[model samples]
Target: MRAVHHLRGAAAAAALTLLAVSGCAEKDGGGGSGAIQVTASDSACKVSRTEFPAGHVKLAVENKGSKVTEVYIYAPGDRIVTERENIGPGTKADITAEVKAGSYEIACKPGMKGDGIRQKVTATGQGSAKPQDPRLDRSVAEYRKYVQAQADETLPKAEKFAAAVKAGDIEGAKKTYAVSRVGWERTEPVAESFGDIDPKVDVREDGLEQGQTWTGWHRLEKALWTDKKIGAAEKKLADQLITDLKDWQKRVGTAEINATSMANGAKELLDEVATGKVTGEEERYSHTDLVDFHANVEGAHKSYELLRPVAAERDPALAAELDKQFKALFTLLDKYREKGSPDGFAAYDTVGKDDRKELSDAVNALAEPLSKLAAAVAS
Candidate 1:
């Protein structure tokens, strides 16, 4: 897994070379209002323009693909400036991102996996010269602190989980697995921005690219529970997990964060819940989906709360709707918790069809309004 990390970084560099060789055209500036258009099909990603003045940029993405898609604005070295994931087939989403004047790639992942198809574009003419609102600035500052705190808290728990794995204590490792992930789940987007850490630590089995060794929590998860044994390979992966997480911890403060990204990140958490946690795919072995489900909601709620001051000022109706939806979702999630145990929820497999539908509906309700948050705060 340690070697796998460096290899992925090399692959990103290779992808950059391919982007340049493929003739990514340049344009100075020319586009109208109402969000930059991005068409995502199975085989192609077409952006409306190759360049634009970039202060607060919005990409209006419509997926024409048969598979679900994800869109990202990545700076060089594959740093994610901002991204919108889980854009289902034939659906549309608006991604509002704050970009400084620089070179970037607008990448579309048709199946919501891999590095994605890249289209090189530049942001021109002093893109972020306009000073932001003071409230927005506070939101960014508080959120940055929150991200650092989550990272700080996550590392210790992950270390404990790793210790259990290395000791060949399967039950001990299993007990700490989901708990270790809560901090990471809460602030995943911030960790993911570093470009290379996420795949090493969080990439699921199906999410792996060709020849990419399956590592991180899920890999160890299968070992402790499904495989029912811990070998040298599992022990090595345990150490690698900590190594990757420690890297994330040290770099959390340095992440490129802004007001819109915070708003977008909150929404991304909901998308994470919708696609992975809610689907029962994220913890296929441990059946700890609800723990992750709670953490994702907590993270999303924190981001929304931090940004609420400005978001409410911009669109009070939207803000009110979000407050209501968030409360409703929490209320629904609480019903599943074991008596007297705040963190314990019924294993996902034991969750009936009706209950799962209720949870899914609540997420959808919150997600629809949450999606508009970036625009509200950006305005």
Candidate 2:
């Protein structure tokens, strides 16, 4: 029994290592030359073939520009599968995905934001690969791991920041808060995509930049950071931040739907925007939506921090390990916050498409660390 368990563990580790090397894994079907050619350009995305036989189809994506790009495959029922990472300009990578007979959209985006070039694809004839089960898919698992990492890595430090503020240690609060921002920024790419979703319905869209109104928490950031006064208003602002942070932490743990719902919601909104069904002005209500999304994630982080004390009580050794991972995540978020300027909108505007792509890449970078933390915490 022990020997069998050891072998199984080794096989799982080997499989994971293979996944890391290939970036994507082959799902089904024997080897063949049946591959779809995909090309990325500065202004558009193109695919040599739109239709393919239903089965395990390999997509060879070639990036022909000066910037890195991401190719996303969206199938029926809003299923998104990604083959992403740094694909340097003038380079190429091949992704093998199990595709079934259905309508699909292949999108290539320079950055994760703005408009991406999309080509529609359809599959006909019989195929071996079956329709993907949404609940148990790898993408969903990846997303969950990402979210949990954000929570575990950043939340506690944010709570410490809040505690410092409450104790009138403003400088300490700022320094501690800086640590939490790193993890937050690490996850920003995935978070920003949430902006493309419907503003009113999705909680993630609370801090968008293109909207007419501004009601999200970042409105407070503008007030606190931009304002000259360091008086009562600052204190009030700090208090509000603390309050919101606490509330967010409480809600995120119990929330049933999770971040995946927000991602699906954003994809739907993006599709609507693409079809000319949803105008930008109508879709982007304000920068508040973006702020709200950040707040939501930050709240989750706070909840994760609160678990630290409990974790320590249960297992001090494990808690120490978790603290290190959390610290790294916090450092990343703080660095991201510092990289941007005081004028938030201007900072966002000044970022080029390539820079945005880097931001998205950074988001993907958090997956492994996050997955490790999530597995450790699993009951």
Candidate 3:
């Protein structure tokens, strides 16, 4: 239950960050035609044109206020078609969207409230403007090279730290671990791209002094470095950390290269719960499984943000599909909170076998879609 609680909190934090950056795209003006103008003042959300010519349309969002803001454009049925992230104070970003003839909503998170400010917009008549493909032609190659170097160089240091521990060189292990951890942190941006990699193997968890550190190699470090007896029990624990390190390295190769796939996979996972295929514990108990689930989703979304431009550039249709998946995921997560677990912590074990199996199946269904999406992006 404790583990689960930790993970849920971490997941929430991660999701907020990823969503802020990944989907924010301004609609471009269709072939020099007049574009809709959206302006956000320090106190209000305003759009110059609520109705526009159908086909290709550009949205120019201006943030004249002194705060960071986000704007989201939604089609009918509350479907978000495009978004602008982190529109700094006194700056503007142009987002281009191909608005088919339909009704839409313009949502602005002036302060990133749980519920954002939403307005209705409509498009009518024949329009045929397409969003320019994102510039992935050069960045994709650079990102791939970056990931490869991280795996080749950073993974070995982790291995060295494990070796130091195995040989009973406590001080040496600590030194190596510190160096390795720093390297891993440097690669955090890229590492977030992979679904299989775990930062706990390399990064130190925070709040150790307050018993708040929950995951990562730091968990092992707490056990190893504490002034406890160094008996067979301690040795066994140390061995487990070493094994985990090796296992993590092997899994690194399986990480998806494309960000959109990672994000889509996360979205699919959340959608499963939304559709009622998966059921979590009745109570808000902290469990390792729950924690891992949250962490996995958060990590996946982070990766998606980094590679979003690539996805938009390479395949706009795919990008749109991915956004659909994300909306579903978020909706499902909101439902999970609303439905609050009935049993709480005790429900984890008391649940019937059939129920457990159903839940497990649901989770896997979510994972499966993500895996397929990731594979597509990597390919």
Candidate 4:
């Protein structure tokens, strides 16, 4: 499996292109009352204030680093309320979010990589203590349960695949490999939520840290698909994967949830599709990009479904437009599926360049409508 480290950079570029497309219709400003001034440099993440009155807030971010940076307002439990991305050096951008009274974190990624430097921020107000958007709350809670269920499925299936490798059965491991990824693909954000474990668990060979032992899915993937043999080292990699995923399962069991997370998680899922899955980069070894593509769509659709009520309640026309776009994307995806995969998805190689470009266009269209979702759900 090739290292897919380029996905984040590519996704950031896509986000910027969309931002420019939308900004053509308007201009950004200092924002309204309670706008927090944020500055990012190679060394630090700074905020104008650590406390706010709660409710609607804006993060007016300035990037001073040489590299591209993005700022995120994170709620408790790794939930990011809002974020502004693709801010190059000397660039200014802002993200407005409806934040309730609670503890939060602000993270700045100078190179658009890793967890980033973080600062703590809080909002204080009588209303902040109370739950906002009961409907959205239910949606987030239900989404978390969905994540838990996916985790439950992922752990054992991964174990089973690992078991095959541990037995030195390369064919058996390859047979179960795609099935093992189903849970992890559906609940990717949860894997990403755990600070460092994510890299150890999912980092591709190209993504390995210097001097760090490569013992995860991609490492094992190479053995099964490239080497066509599972050695003792490969078996040990399998053991480590199980170890890390077990931690992933435990951490997600106690994880937090909110409407903002649901909105962003949906975007992240689509970003996965646009960045790696669409290009057939993620499944370089197994040619299983279609499997991941379908899973990403499924996960994104679930996230969008959870936030549909809030968006619809705010703007019926926009909601209908988004629903139509969603169906259009899904209808295109439907053609690729048949009696094949464990989930009935054909391989990524089945699609030609023209079909791939068409699918990519569909993802971009959906992203435009999906970008407005967080604002519509905002209080």
Kindly list the per-residue Cα lDDT of model 3 for residues 260-353, writing each as its tens digit: 3234434433433322223442111222123223333444454554566665665666666655655554443333231233211222334456
Candidate lDDT values, in order: 0.74, 0.42, 0.47, 0.70
Best by lDDT: 1
Query: Candidate 3 versus the native: TM-score?
Result: 0.36
Report the C-alpha lDDT of model 1 over 321-369, residue by residue, as the tens digit. 9999999999998888886433477778899888888899999899888
Stretch of 10 with least lDDT, candidate 1: 17-26
Q: Count the backbone clashes (under 3 Å) in each candidate.
A: 0, 23, 28, 1
Question: What's the TM-score of every candidate structure?
Answer: 0.83, 0.40, 0.36, 0.76
Worst 10 residues of 4 by lDDT: 17-26
Query: What lDDT is obtained when candidate 2 is compared to the true structure?
Result: 0.42
State in Å the error of residue 180, model 1. 1.4
TM-score of 1: 0.83
Best-fitting candidate, measured by TM-score? 1
Report per-prediction Cα RMSD to one decimal.
6.1, 14.7, 18.9, 6.4
